[model samples]
Target: MVSLIRSALLLAAVASVALVGQASAECETIYVRREVRDLADEEWRVFVEAVQKVMKTEKPQEADGQAMTIYDDLVKQHLDYQDKCHGTPIFLPWHRAFLKTFELELQKAVPGVVAPYWHWGFDSQAPHHSEVLSHKYYGGAGQGEQSCVPDTPFKDYKPTYTADGMPKCICRQYDDNGNRIAPFSPIEELASIVENSPDFDDFSSRIEGNPHGLVHNGIGYGFSSMSSPSDPIFFAHHAFVDMLWAKFQERE
Candidate 1:
């Protein structure tokens, strides 16, 4: 009986050590990405400030010493890669990689900063009026025929490059025929897309077609074209799309 008890105790100690090792491995692999709504006001402020800093900081000196900020680099990247990244089989993964890299850049400025995602489905009923567009956030609708944004953090933002490779003020066109742009696809619609899609290609295609394209059209101007990243909301919108893809992945 004594020998049996000692064996049992030794086995228990070994099991405990193994369990601790397993937990340490799991901790090393696990990471958390938060949604836009989940972020506190302070967290959002930090993210926004980091992005603004990137926008102001110029790129490395070249032959011509181009006055390109990190923000300009991102815009140029999107403009250059839009054709390869959009409406293709690799669309979702490409954007996912872009957002991750962009988040890393943001974190370099403000440690622990994660890009926040906008849940457009939640505001599908009244996307234009959503708090995301409030003066406290991305600002209200565009003003005048050119649809130039008037009262937002980016109102004074002048990009060095656009789809046309020309300097222009950041702009948004939010209406047509005296009506607000169409609302984003609701959660129900997304649910259907996930359920009906048989593979990653089909799933991503559906997402890009509906919620993705609709949001761009709804925002108009820079957002409606390859120069979408020129608008800060572009990241938030794409992050939410990535979140939805993750949601679908969870079921698999």
Candidate 2:
């Protein structure tokens, strides 16, 4: 009887292990296609020309109004029109694709031009001394290093790409048995996603209120309210966050 009971326990343990392994596989980060490399020399000039047009009219308006109107109408509108992709959790895929499109468009418009994506990753080293997203007052370590831990797994963990050349990371979704379930909830799993990513957030504190708000002094200038476009990192940062959401949508 004792031997039979021991055998049963072993079988249960194995089953639990299998279930956990299966769960983690369910929630993994998905990568956006890196087709921004397709922009030809001629197209680059057209893109730059668009950028010039956009910059001239993108006046800051504190929180909202003309600046936002011009941004949505002239800049964002053009990029979204080109992506041809949509879906809720797919926010990052669309934005990354959109940024790439915008970059390529600018290059097409300007010729031999390269536009930079405002990277929040830089703040991990930027001299700012407070956490960017945290309501608390901790920023940088004062030595130009991040004092807070990163929430986004990609920020610190680099995933091995698939044969098709797509990057992958651990997804934030988990099942009842502590296994990850795919189609992860963006609103639900965002905090875990952020906390897990490395070199992403300088603000050690988790974001409260709206996860979508702009940074307010955690890392010098973190995210800002998006009504206006004064903050440079706004679009890129949101785009990064969106990417995490898209990955959560695809599960094994």
Candidate 3:
């Protein structure tokens, strides 16, 4: 009887081990989005390529009275929902969802692609001089009247929608009164705002008021308008904003 009992106990233990192993194998690993600064040159290349693909690919279905590219649809969505999504309780959550959707779309174009956050805190000191503004990257400061964007991957690329209700080339103006617009709010400033806010409402207000507003305004021209998402950097900028909110959540 003792020998039979030992055999039964050993069989149960083996079955348990097998079940645990199977469960472990079936679990999916979750991926965390990284900062744009952390992306390698090759990774940045892949991301840029994916963005271009989405920009050039036309949407198969006309949802809002026109056939548009995936990129144009995103711009239109932002324009349509701007009032509901900005400066309200839904602001953070709405943007978070939007970022996730955009990231997924990007992945569909380029497998394993993830949207990267721009840590503007690091670039706040001298944003106009930041490497992200290089000709090899998003492009340099605008030139000529109207502050038209020049010499970048997107210089010649025109968007289907604009703030004025017409199609136009990507436009940006980094200068104001003969000097680059003020540097964006630094990380230290952002930390102070997040740490001081007593609730979600205050936190959202403070964030939208400063760094968020500062970055958009500093970029000037197209970036300053309601259709700001037309600029590719808009995604990276907002991703960091979302990260800041996540940081605030952790502390609370």
Candidate 4:
């Protein structure tokens, strides 16, 4: 059992209630997670604005002597405990709950909004062409010294931590020359991987590797670190991952 203790200090006084108080005792409320492209302009605005707001909001407690944003604190949790969560069956359940915590924290700015999914499969043919990589969303690959992304709203953000501990920028190293991001695993391949698995372990192992790695490797060089949550897209990317698991459950 991976210890939940790793995250026990996460806004414990503020989020403890959100984590438990909002549980539907009888399972009555159904929340919808929308695809990023499908969101209405206003809905997209709300989501983006909320993310920016939380990026600036302080955590109740300083986790690293420096007062980090709620976003970075979440990142630190992964840095502190990724070994227990990834490359194991627990990855699925651990991230599922972790995503929930992210959504609740986001609610601090946009009460009703949940994370959105990136259906990268649609852009599999040419990932650099993805609007998500354009200034419209998270912005394209980094440029210049440190490859600091200079287009996304986060361009100005100096996240407190990184694997190198010095980027001071969310650095995505997409060569962006049509080849940096190889074609994503085909959607049918992803669905098939999920659909063909006969049981939990089978499904979890298959889904966690290919397409999962595709999402991370294809575009998030900035995120393969202890401070990955510093990039807001991490949660959305995982939201789509979680949806695939939900699809498998419904299929079974």
Best by TM-score: 4
User: What ranges in model 4 sit over 4 Å off?
Assistant: 1-25, 62-64, 175-179
Check candidate 1 and list the clashing pairs.
36-117
Best-fitting candidate, scored by lDDT = 3
| Candidate 4: C-alpha lDDT | 0.74
Q: After superposition, how far is residue 88 of candidate 3 from its true place, in Å?
A: 1.2
Error of 2 at 186 (Å): 19
lDDT of each: 0.74, 0.33, 0.76, 0.74
Assess every candidate by TM-score: 0.83, 0.31, 0.84, 0.85
* Candidate 2 residue spans exceeding 4 A from truth: 1-53, 57-90, 112-114, 118-223, 229-231, 238-252
Q: Which residue window of length 10 is worst by lDDT in model 2?
A: 135-144
**On residues 35-62, what C-alpha lDDT tens digit does candidate 3 reach at each position?**
8768888988899899999898888866
Give the alpha carbon lDDT tens digit for every residue of 1-252 in model 1.
133234434543442343344343444433466766677888778878988877787888557877788888788777767776788766776677677667777877887777888888889877887888777777667677666677767766778777663237667777454237677788899888877778666787899997789998887777787877878888989998988877766556
Candidate 2 local lDDT, 1-252, one digit each (tens): 133234434543442343354444543533232222244545434433555444444435545443442333423342333223222222233344445444444444454444433223333333232133222211112111221123321123222211122223212111222121112124444546554534222211223222333232332211211121222233444454444433433321
Each model's Cα RMSD? 12.2, 20.2, 12.9, 5.7
The superposed Cα distance between candidate 4 and the true structure at residue 152, in angstroms, equals 1.0
What tens digits encode model 4's per-residue C-alpha lDDT throughout 30-104?
679988888898888898888888788887764446878887777777777777678876677677778887887
Total residue pair clashes for candidate 4: 0
Give the Å error, residue 214, model 3: 0.6
